[model samples]
Target: MTTVDPTYAACPVPLPESERVLLGHGAGGQLSADLVTGLLLPALGSAAPAGPLEDAAVVPVGGVDVVISTDAYVVSPLFFPGGDIGCLAVHGTVNDLAMRAATPVALALAYVVEEGFPLADLRRVAASAGRAAAAAGVAVVCGDTKVVGRGAADGLYVVSTGIGHRPPGAAPSAGAVVSGDVVLLSGPIGSHGTAILSVREGLGFDADIASDTRPLHRLVAAMTAAGGTGVHALRDPTRGGLASALNEIAAASGVPVEIDEAALPVPPAVAAACEILGLDPAHVANEGCLVAFVAPERADEVLTAMRGLPEGGGAVRIGTVADHGEPGRVTVRTAVGSRRVLDMLVGEQLPRIC
Candidate 1:
C-alpha cells in the first residue's frame, strides 16, 4: 500500500498535483501567487500581515517610513542588448522602491559565482554594477561574494537589496486606488522581455530591438511632483507584464479596471515579434515602464509631466476606473467593439524571462 500526505487537501491556490516545485514557481505568474498565499504566508502565521507581499515592504522607522526591497537576477545571457544582469539587479531593486514614492539611499549586493568563470567577465559585471549605482545616485554600502564548484551554478547570479525613504505626504499604495481614477502607462511595452528572447533563441529582430532596462526613479519622482497626493498607486509592469500589474491593483483596491486595446502603445517591432511568437505584447515583461493610478482631475497634468521626461516621453492614458463591472475585474475594450477579460497568467508563457 502507498501512503499519501493529507496536507495537499487544504491547498488554497491549486498546485499541479505534484509533490515538488516546477519552473513555473519562479515565473511570477499564478503559481508564484499560489505559493505565497498557500504556503509562505500561512507559515508566517495569521498575525504576520494582511495580503501577499507587494514588490517592496514599507516598515515604520520611528520618525519616518523606510522602504526596503530586494531581487535576484539569473538571466542566462549575462550580457543582453540593452543591459547586463548586474545593472538589471540594480535597476530592479531601485524601481521597486521608486514605485512606492520612495527615494533610494543605499544598496547592498551579493554574488554567487561558478568555479572556472572568467575573471574578466566578473570584473566587467562588477564595474557595471558600480556605474549603475553611481548613476542612480545611490551608494553601494555593502557586498559579498562566493564561488561554487563547476556546473554547480550558473556563470554568476546577483542578489541585491535597496533601502529608501518615502517622500513626505506621498503615499502610493494599491489600497489607495479608487473608482473614477485614471490609468497611465509610462511608455511602450515588451521591449526588455523580447530583447532577451531574441538573444537567447537567436531571433533575427536584433538590428533594431533592445531592452528598455533603465532606472525609473526619476520618472516616478516627476509624476509625484506634478500630481502630489492625486497619484494613488504606482507600479512598474515587470515580471508578469502589464496584465498582471493591473489585475493586482484591481484586486488590492476592490475596483474594476478597463483599458482600451487600441490605446495600448506597443512599438511596431515589439508587436511584430509578439505576434510571431503568439504572445500578447501586453503580457510580455518590461523593465523600465510604469503604470500609474491617479485622480481624474490631475491625470492630464500628470501625463504632461511624464511626457516632459525622456523616459516617459511615450506616456499615455490607456484606461479608466469603472463604477459597474465585476469587482477586481480587468477588461480590455477590443478595437472591433468587443470586450476581453484580461486574466492573470495561469501558466508560464516565457520561462526565465526576467
Candidate 2:
C-alpha cells in the first residue's frame, strides 16, 4: 500500500495573492504549487486540495482512494464537432489520472486570453468546462486568469488540473504488466485525430466526424471494481495514440506485445480519413479511450466491466503481452494473418492537432 509521507505538508509553498499566473506556473516545480495554494485554493475555498502536488494530485477518500489530474487547453479551433478544447482539456487530464484507477475528485482551471478575444467565446468555453466537470462528478474548485497583449497569444488557452484518490488494494502501473497478460481497448479509435484533421484540412465528408473527448474515470473505476488486481496497467491512447502508448508499456515492462489488426476497433469515418491521408488509425490519437493490460485469467472480466460503461461500450480484447521475443519489439498480426512490426511514432503526424 502506498502511504503519504508524514513530512508532506498540506501546502508546501508559501501562499501569496497573485492577480495572474506567470509562465513559471507551468514549470511543474515549486512555483506551480505556490500559485495553487497561495492563490487558486484560497479563492476556491480553505479546504485543502488532494493528490501529489506533482503533475497531478492524489487524494484519500473513504477506505478506497482517488486521484486528480489537470491539463491545459491550447488546441487551435477551440470548437470542434463532438466537443471543444475546453472540454477536451478536462477529459484529457481526468483520463490520465483515471488510468491509475483513481477516482477523480476536483479540478482547478487557469485561462490565458488574448486581449481582443471575444467575451462570448470565453463564456462558452468556461461553461463547457464546468458542465464537463459536473458530468464527470468532479467539481471545479479554483481557477485564475490572465490577458496577454493582442496577437501575443492565441485566442485563449485553458489549463485545468485535477485531484483524485486511488482505491485501496489497486495496483495499477505499466510495470505490473507481465507475460501472458491480455491487452484491451476501450472502444473505436482515431475519431479525435480524424476530427481534428478534418477541421484543419477543411475536408468535407458525408459523415459528420467529431472528437471522442469525454471523461473515463467512472469506466476505469468500474473495471477495477470488477477485476480487482487483475487490471495490471491502463493507459489512455493520447498524443501518440495506441502505437506509441503500447511501445512505452512494452519497453517499461520488458515485455513483447502482439496486437491483432482485425480485432482493433476503428470507426468507419476514422478509417476513411486515415485511408485518404495515408495515416494508420492505430497511429492516430484518441482523447476519450484507453488501453488496458490485464492478467489472462481476469481479462474477460475486466473487458466486460469496461464494455458496461458508456465510454467503453465497444471495448475489446485486442492482444497479449509476452516475454520479449525480441527486446523492445511490438508486433501486430495484419488483416491477412501476417505479423508486422509496429514502430514508435518518430515525428509529429498532425502537429498541434491535440
Instruction: Give the lDDT of residue 350 in candidate 1.
Output: 73
Cα RMSD for candidates in order:
4.9, 8.7
Residue-level lDDT of model 1, residues 242-336, one tens digit each, is 88788888887878999999989988989888988888887788989999999999999999999999999999999999988987889999999
Q: What is the C-alpha lDDT of each candidate?
A: 0.83, 0.75
List residue ranges in candidate 1 displaced over 4 A.
1-18, 46-52
lDDT of 1: 0.83
Error of 2 at 287 (Å): 1.0
Q: Report the C-alpha lDDT of model 2 over 57-109, residue by residue, as the tens digit.
A: 44566754566565666676788778887888788878878887777777888
